[model samples]
Target: MKPLELYLHIPFCIQKCNYCDFLSAPSCAGERKVYVESLCQKIRSYKDLAKAYHVVSIFVGGGTPSLLLSKQIEQIFEAVRETFVIDSDAEISLEANPGTVTEEKLQAYRNCGINRLSIGLQSAKDRELKRLGRIHTYEEFLWTYELARKAGFLNINVDLMSGIPLQTLVDWEETLHEVARLKPEHISAYSLIVEEGTPFYERYGNGKHLEELPDEETERKMYYRTREILESYGYHRYEISNYARLGYECRHNLGYWNRTEYLGIGTGAASLIREERWNEGEIPEKLDRKAQMEETMFLGLRTMKGVSKAEFAKTYQRTMESVYGKVLEEMQKKGLLLVGEDQVCLTDAGIDVSNYVMSEFLL
Candidate 1:
């Protein structure tokens, strides 16, 4: 049977963060029931497509999936079981915000078979959290973490931000140290991006920038520092922005990076099945490889594991070295790529400049 991963988006937040552009709206208590029903309708419509696959993972993410009441979470889980042949040991995960998680809520999630939890704890510093417009404080996040543990969540991932306005290299180190004390099963350290149309773009895009936010060089140093510190604590850098304990890597995210078949259900979600990638509609061929090789190369480079040379040759009937000799040689000389026996992956330098490296594959 084909292996499948599922993603469900719940686009409701108590309040939208200033820097976020995800498909989420401020939750009006009166409107939540209607929105939940709409979500259930979407799940029902797509249920038939998932019946044949052996569901390996189920991830519910959003503005804050924790905003949904326990009953709502139960309904979603029931719908998923009814629709898919979920594996007995599937990695079921839910994204929760620190502000909303409570002891009772965590216990309820455990009861519903949510084996993993990804909590958004952007920063441990209150001032930085305020600058990012985060709804929770560091103390609140700690409370949530303790509650999750008490409620029997053995696998938890904490989200941290590195390139926030007014953040420094020292601040990055402190954040890592604090998180290490919590001893989560996984950590995702992401750099901040000032996307267009956000309040941040309008307010601080042009004129004044926060001095605390480090420059490009400093950002690179911060990433390497984070990787080094996390590695010491036994967290493996499986992906560019994610680290996990030996056996606790997030299967849901790994499925995406490996270009495995997945089903995304919700407004604005993306999916890939049967070698066809779709987000609203099919992704342009120009944006990806023809069928298999495109996903293989692009997705492979995103992880520390990189792409396998033999696998590429087997799929394309040409060694990757022969196909892109000049580019590989140039990148290797620049220390951006480290070619290995069977695989080739990005170096720290390459990961720091991944956008440029990823663009090279486009040609």
Candidate 2:
């Protein structure tokens, strides 16, 4: 059997953040109960496919998965275990926010085999936290981190953001240092994009927030210095925005960049399996060879290792150079790509303008 990854989406948040546009919203107890029941039904529906592949990772992401009652969390995992053959060392992760998790919930997560916890602490400064519409204070995030460690969760990730409105470069550096002081196993530092339809869009969308937001030079500095600061704290950049200790990289996400087959089960979740892709309500579209090759380059380039030439040739039964030799040569000349003997990857400068670099791979 091949390896597989699972994503269980919990779409209930206590209150949505202003800068957030994920598919989540406030819900009552009855609504949560109904959602959990339906989610478990989806898990059970995959038992047959479970025989064809063993689960290598399970990521329970949300709208604040920590908001669920311990019993509900347990119920969801029970269905997963019964319906899937999980690898012994499979990485089971849950996304959480502060002010929603408790000691009982942490213990229950341990009991339910959740081995990793990703705490969302966008900024370490209270003022910045308030500006983001996050419900918890930095102090509350610290409390949650300590509680999770005390509960024996050895693998923990801290989620952070840079380049938000009213955040200076110094404030971004301090936020990095403050989070690094705790030494999470992994860190995901992302730049804030002004996604449409959120409160941020209303206030700062369509060429707004020029004064409130950092300038272009400051944003560039944030992107460049993140790797330097995190590496000084003993973390390595495994992907463009993800840093981790030697062996603690998030396997579920790696599966995505590596194009491993995965099953995403929940409201509006997507799925890719056996070279066929589909969303929750959409019919599956079989990925043609050219489409597959494009996905292989674009998705794989997100990682530090980039894509492998030998593996590409093996899968497609053609030479990687024959397909994109000119593109590689041009990119290498521009210092935007590194074409090693076995693999090709984006340089630091390339990652800064990755949208343009990746777009060139389209056939």
Candidate 3:
């Protein structure tokens, strides 16, 4: 059977962070229960499609899935298993935030076959957390982390962010050191981007509070410092912004970078199957060969391992050289790309300006 991935989005949170533009908001218990029930019904609607593939991974993400009662979580997964053929060794992950998890909830998750926990702890500094409109303090995150460990969660990921108003290089370094010492299996260290529609955009997008945020040079330093510190703590940079110990890379995210087909279910989730993309409330977009090729290059190059030349040929029936030869030559001369006999990827310098480098592959 074909390998498939499942993403279930839970659009409920205790509070919306200032920097967050995700599809979630504060929800009442009644609303949450209704949503969960609706979501399970949607899962049941996919029974026919499930016969064509076996699910390899499941990611429950957004607004803070941990906010739900453990029973609600169990109900959702029960519906999934009833309708889908889940692989025995599938990696099941749930996104959580501090101050929203409990020992009972953690144990319930384990009992329901959830094996991985990705906790949101954007900063180790309480001041930064408050400035970002985070609901919990640094101490609350520590409590949540220790509780997850005690609940027998062997695989865990901590989400950290750099670049906030009044954040300094020292602050960023402290956050990394504090979290890495606990030794989570994975760490997604993301640079803060002031996205549109977020409160941060009001403050920084029009250059209103730009002076309060780190300068471009300092932000770059924080990026490098994340790698420098995480590597010392035994984590390797597998993706542009993600670090993990050997064998602990997030399989669900890797699937996205590698073009694995996935089904997304929720208010605004997206799905890709048979080279066609579907988003809720929109017409399905059937990716043509050119669009698919662009996705293959841009997405695959996000990883340190890069894209395999042979696999590209197998998928497209066109040599990687035949398609990107000139672009590769140009990038190689500029020291922005490394072309191996079997693979092609970005160099460290190239990753620093990866947006420009990946844009070169847009054929």
For model 3, residues 72-157, the per-residue Cα lDDT tens digits are: 99999999999999999999999999999999999999999999999999999999999999999999999999999999999999
Worst 10 residues of 2 by lDDT: 205-214
lDDT of 3 at 79: 99
- lDDT of each prediction vs. the true structure? 0.85, 0.94, 0.94
Q: Could you estimate the TM-score for every candidate?
A: 0.93, 0.99, 0.99
What does candidate 3 score in Cα RMSD to the true structure?
0.8
| Deviating ranges (above 4 Å) for candidate 1 | 207-212, 280-291
* TM-score of model 2 (CA atoms): 0.99
Expressed as tens digits, the lDDT of each residue in 216-238 for candidate 2 is: 99999998888889999999999
Give the per-residue lDDT of model 1 (tens digit) for 1-363. Answer: 789999988888987776888888887776777777777777777666766689999999998999989988888888777778889999999999988987778888988899999999989899999998999999999999988988989999999998888788898899999998889999999988877788877766765565645787898889889989999888999999999999998999988888778888776778887766666434623323444665677778999999989988987788887766777778889999988788888998898788788667754
Compute the lDDT for candidate 1.
0.85
